[model samples]
Structures are given as C-alpha cells and as structure tokens.
Target: MPERPILVFDVNETLLDLDALRPAFDRIFDDPGAMRLWFANLVTYSEALTLSGAYVPFTDIGGAVLRMLAATRDITISDADGAELTERFGSMPPHPEVPAALRRLRDHGFRLFTLTNNTLEVSERQLERAGVIDLFERRFSVETVRRHKPAPEVYQGVAAALEADPGDICMIACHVWDTIGAAAAGWQSALILREGNAPLDVGPQPDYIGQDLDAVADRLIERYGGRGPDRGRTMPPLLD
Candidate 1:
C-alpha cells in the first residue's frame, strides 16, 4: 500500500468560516447575498488576472472586487469601509469542527500544511486568530509563485517547497476547483462540501468528499492512518 500522504489544506472557506464576513457585506451592500457575490467575483477576477499573465495581490483583488460590486449597485464604499472589510476577512473564525479535526489528523501522524491564495501575512493573521495556526507545519501562499488556486503552477510550487513529489501530498479543500488543480498536479485530494460548495461532475475530481472537516478526517484516518512510517498498527480513536 502507498504511504500516508502529507496533508495540504486550503484556508479560506475550507478551514475558516467565510460567513463571518457576512455582517460587513450586509452593512456595506445592504444585501444579504452580497458577500457571496463579492467572493465569486474576487475568485473570477483573480483567475482572470492569472490566466491573462497579470498578477495582483489577493487582498488588492479582494478590494477591487468589493469596489466593483459596490459600483454595480451604485453604492459608495469609503476607505474606512474597505479597511473594515479587509480586517474582517483576516479575522474569520475556523468552522466549529475544524480545530479538533485538524488536531486529530495531526495526532494520526499525518503532517499538515496549508496553501492559500491569500498572502502569507493575511493567512498567518487568519489562522492565528482562529487559534489553529500552531497545527500547521508550514503555510504556503500562491503570492510567492505569482499565481492563484486552480493553477497547476501554484500546486507544483507547494510540492517544490516541501521538496516532496506531488503524489506525496493530499490536498483537502472545500472548493472543487482547488481539488481539481491538485489532482492535475498528481496529488490526491479530499473535498469538504462546505455549505456553498458541491462536487462537479466533469474534469479531475477529488479522491474523497465529506460534509465537513471532521468527516474528511475520519476518511483520511481510515484510509491511511495505519500506513504511515510507523506502519501496520491500528489507529487510535479520533479525538472528541
């Protein structure tokens, strides 16, 4: 059997709760759904910039997308409003089960890391605020490679940094596009079906799917826990 894979995670919406920013969206756009729209547009434009051979910082893209969204409704956003949005984004909390699930995976002997489109500074603040920063061995930002998620280069960059083969990593993320990219890079992947995300029927797909990090952790432990360097022993029960 193959050795257990190192776990590489996506931060936003995968580990952290994006809904934490909804209040800012509601106040800024006066629309309950504006946060989702702004996020979708942020991803879209980020990918567009990457594909077109232009690179912009993720936070800058986020701010630009917020402005674009505001313009759509002829709503004016002040500098203070933009700053508040940025602050809120960086302080999102982990999903309720994320901390324990992450600790469980670490306890099972799976090395953990993070790869995010957010800049290292932003991601550091995010995970630190969420109280799980200590769980990750390393955190990678696509900013280092001047690319974004769903880009093969970004995935490859992570493998290169870790000095591991792509096949040695298993990416866990909430977005299908992310898993698709990791799969293309020859990494196994698990998709967490966060409320707003669902698996796609076409193209490369994740090897596993679960409704939450806890569920995904269970699957990972079942499949690979006994296959780590200290092999052939039954895994311990998951943490409560």
Candidate 2:
C-alpha cells in the first residue's frame, strides 16, 4: 500500500472499453475505420474546445463524432444508430482483469478513485453493467471541469477532490496523452498496455508500465511493499 493516497484511474478508455462500438460504426458508415476516425476526431475537437475556453459536455463529443463519421464516409448515419453507439458506450463492461486487480489494491489498503471525462449517468450505468461499482471510493467526472483528458485543470480537479496532492495520485490508463496530462499536472502515471494502443513517447515515461491492471498491482506491491504503507520516491521518466 502507498503510505500516501493514490487515486488510480481514467474511466472511458481506461476502465470501460468503448471499442464495442467499432463494428456498429462499420455497419453504419460502410467503413471499417469509422470508429477509429471518430474517436480520433472526438479527442481532437474536445481538446480544441477546452483550449479555446469553450465548455462542451462530454456527451456532445459523442454527437460530434457521429456527425464527423457521417461526413467522412459519405453515409447517412441514422439517429437510431448514433444512439445505439452511445448506448454501447453507456453499457460498456470492464476489461477482464480490472476487477480483480482493483480488489487487490484495495485489500492492500490503497485508496482508490476514478477520474474521467464521462458524464455522471453514463459512467454509473457502465460501471453497474461491469459490476465493479464497489471498487472506487469516489468517481471524479470532468463534467465538473467541462474539459477533456490531457488537460492540467481536469487532472487538478481530480486531485483537489481527493485532498490528495497531484504527486500522490497516479494516473493509470491505456492512453499516452492522458498520462501525459497527469504528469504535466505533477501526478505519478502508468500505462496499461492494451491491444492497439501504441507505446507512449512522453518526456516523463510513466512511473510504471504493465500488461494489465493485475500486473500493475503486482508492480505496485513491489515498489511500495505489501506489508506496510510507504511514502513515494520520485520515479524517473521511463527511457530505454
């Protein structure tokens, strides 16, 4: 267990896998890469809105992704299909290994919280579907900040809510830029190596990297020791 608190997550891509929407997107757009492009554009535009000092709800990002997919593929995306894709988003299940890993961390006395750009209702429904509702002590949504991932203010809000310093919270995720934002905000970070996510190239490499959350929990036990809580040491940027 960490002697100090450690908030450990990013919800959408990190906890809930929305890639379940991929085939649905392909069906609607007649393009296999439709989901990929939609997700990419969603991240890009969300960041653009935040940087320009405009506030948009996270669900609005979904609508924008749907619209972009329609235009790029020259296919008419029906309102029914668009709602289905997001309904898939709301109905996501956790990765196979997440529940056990989070359980081990909690058993070892590590405080847990989740931070994400997902709206409250969406996240709650997804977590309920996955049956991981008991895992997090708190769930911090970016709805409060009206911004997306990789934003320092959003990360800062998460830290503030826990009364935990930025450095004490470790941002764990499958996305490079999400951890980059956490690091920029002075948080410890890790990459949960997942299929299709390329390795990160951030200046400060994540403090830990693992094949899955279970591997992450094992490494956590190693670094901090399972028998007793330990204060953090500055983890050097990962470089090979």
Candidate 3:
C-alpha cells in the first residue's frame, strides 16, 4: 500500500464558495462578473509578485486587484464598498457538501490540514466562519514562508511543517496550477473540478480528480481508509 498521506487543502475557492462574494460586486458594479474578474486578477498579480520575490498578504493583493480591475472598466467604487467586499470574502461559507466531506475524511483516520495563500489570521477567520475549523488539525499559510502557492517552497514548506514526506502528503485543491505544483514537488494531488475550473494539459496530471469535495473524499477513503494494519476494518458509507 502507498503511504497514508496527510491531506492538505487549499482554502479559497476549493473548499469555500467564492460566489458568496458576488453580491458585493453586484452592488458595487452592477455586474456580478466583477467578482470573477477581481479574483482572476488577484491571483495573477499575486503569482507575479511571488515570481518577483515580493510578498504581500493575499487579502491585500485582493484589494489592490479590485481597484485595478475597477480602473480598467472605469467603475468607481467607494472605500466602504471595497472594505465591505474584503470583509465579506473573509467570511464566505464553504461550498455545499464540503463540511460533511471533511468530517468523513477526518472520521476515517486521515489527518487534515489547510495550505492556503492567505495569511494565518485570514485563514483562521474564513475557516471559523465556514464552521469547519475544528475538522483540521493545523492550518498552514505561505505567508510564513514568504511565498505564495504554486511556488515549490510553499508546498515543500507545508510538508516540512507537518513532518511528513512530500510523497506522503496529498494536496487537494480546485486549481489546476496548485495540483500540478504539488505533483511536481512529489506530493500526491487531487483536483476538484468545481464549475468554471478544469484540468490543464501542460504538466503532470493530478493523481485524483473529482467534481467536488465529497467526490474526492469518497475516492480517498476508498483507496486509503482500510489499508495496511487496518485491513480488517470496514469503512463507513459516504455521507450523502
């Protein structure tokens, strides 16, 4: 049997529904699509900053990107609107079925952790708001390592922090770049293909892929739950 790997989750968009922030965008720009544009720009700039060897908190990049996106479209946003959007993002709820899926994995003996590009304070606030904070044993952030994810150091640092071999850690995320990065770093990866996300053809494919967190959790439990010394144990049925 392959090693029973520790599960490291990506916080934003993977487990949480970023759609929750759409209303804020709608109120500001009269276009819900602004949230999507803002998010994409935030990620692009964050990665660019990382490659340039500069580090900023994810939320700060998010705010900067929101303004840049507004400028591109000639939409003026109030300071209160921007601040409200930032606050709403930090308290977005988990995607449907995520909480139960996490509990199922935890109950089946897998150790769970979060590896997010967000700072520790924001990660904690988001998870706490999502009501799944207790399901994780530890929450990791690239801020500690002074880099954002898809950067090899972020993945390696997560494994190092958990005291687990890179190969014995599984990075679960909705972003193809994240999965590809983890795979390249020698960690197992599961890609959750949530709507508006898909796999890329460019690099090593993820070891596992699913439509949502529940689907991925089912696969993980089936493959790793009752293996090894627990071979005789019966795994529980997946939650609906």
Candidate 4:
C-alpha cells in the first residue's frame, strides 16, 4: 500500500469518458464535433466566470453553453433537447481501462477521492453509472466552495475536506489545466494524456504523465505502493 497523500481524481474526462456523449451531440446537432465544441466552451466560460468572481452551478453553465453554441450556429434546439445534453452528462461510462486501473489503485491501499467542477449530485450519479462508486471514499465538488477548478480555492478546499496538507494530495486528471491548478496549489499531480488532450506549455509541469489510467496506476504503484503508510513525502515537481 502506498503511504501518505490522497489520490484526488478529476471526474469528467478523467475517470468518466466525455467522448461517449458524441452520439448525443450527433443526434441533437447532427455534428459529432458539437460535443467537443460544447465541452470546450463550457470549460472556457466556467473559468471565465471564476476569474471574474462570478458563480453558477456547473450543470446550469453546461446547459447555458449549449444554448449559446446553438445560437452561434443558428441552430434552434428545444428545451428538452438542451436538457438532454447535460442530463446524459452524469451517466457516462468509464473509459476501457478505468475500472481495472481504479481497482489496482484501490488494492494498492491509497486513499481515493474525486474533486470535480461539478455538483455533488451529478458527480455521484456519474461515478455510479460508471460502476466505480465503491472504489472512492468520497466525491467532492467545487460547488460546495462555489468555485470552479484552476482557482486555488477548489484544490485547497479538497485538502481541507480531506484534513490533509495540500502537499499530501495527488491530483490526477487528463486536463493540463487541472493538473497545473493542483500543482500551483502545492499538490502532487499526474497528467493522464488521453487522446485529443495535451498538456499546456504554460504553468508548472505535472509530476507524472501517462497514456491512460492504467499507465498512470502503474507508475503510482511503482513509486508509492507498499511503504506501509509511513512514506512521508516531497513536493517535487515532475518535468514535462
């Protein structure tokens, strides 16, 4: 079992596959790429609001962004169809390697938790749908803190919630911004390089990088497993 620091995962696009929503986008917008656009815009605007000291529920932001995207393209979508976009967000499946990797990490005895820019309700449903709810000790959302990620409050809030020093948490996610945010907040971080995702050239580099969840788990177990819970640690930054 790895000693010290909680493994804090980002739910969307990290454990749950956002690409699975492509078919919904295709059905609604007739453009498979619409899912990609909607997600990118959602993240972009969410951060924009956070930086401006504004706040909104993550799901509300998601639905609003969908409408805005439709407007930009002169695409009129009914309210029901708009709701469907985010209604399905909480039921995405895990990526192919997610379940096994989660089990591997759990069996290694590291504490596991999720920190997301989502509501607690949605995060729970998403994990449940993915069938990995039992693998996590808790699910955290920035909504409780009323802040979205990349903001220092979100990461610090997780550390506070876990009753651990910020350095005693490892943030694992596929988004460079998410890892960078954790790093800046003084937590260890891993970048899971899912396809169509890449680390940003700016900010502190992640402590580990991998092709998938399984690859990330391999490195975590190798580095931190079997230390009998006394592996007092460092905040060394991993280079890109």
> Which candidate model has the greater lDDT, 1 or 2?
1
Relative to the true structure, candidate 4 reaches a TM of 0.90
Least well predicted 10-residue stretch by lDDT in candidate 2: 227-236
Clashes of each: 0, 0, 0, 1
lDDT of 1: 0.91
Tens digits of per-residue lDDT for model 2 on 1-240? 446448568887677776777778778877777777787788888889889988788778779767876876577768788788878888777888888888778767688888877787777777888888788888778888877887888988887877877888888888887888888999998888876676666476788888888888888877776543332433456832
**Per-residue lDDT for 84 in model 2?**
89
Which of 2 and 4 is the better model by TM-score?
Answer: 4
Cα lDDT tens digits for candidate 1, 80-112: 898888888989999999999998788778999
- Best-to-worst lDDT order: 1, 3, 4, 2
Candidate 3 segments exceeding 4 Å error: 227-240
Residues 45-160 of candidate 4: C-alpha lDDT, one tens digit per residue: 99999999999988889888988998888998897786676667878899999988887787667788998998998899889888999999888999988989989999988888
Q: Which candidate is the best by lDDT?
A: 1
For model 4, the stretches where C-alpha displacement exceeds 4 angstroms are 227-240
Global lDDT of each candidate: 0.91, 0.79, 0.88, 0.87
Each candidate structure's TM-score, on Cα atoms with residue i matched to residue i, is: 0.93, 0.89, 0.92, 0.90
Which one is best on TM-score?
1
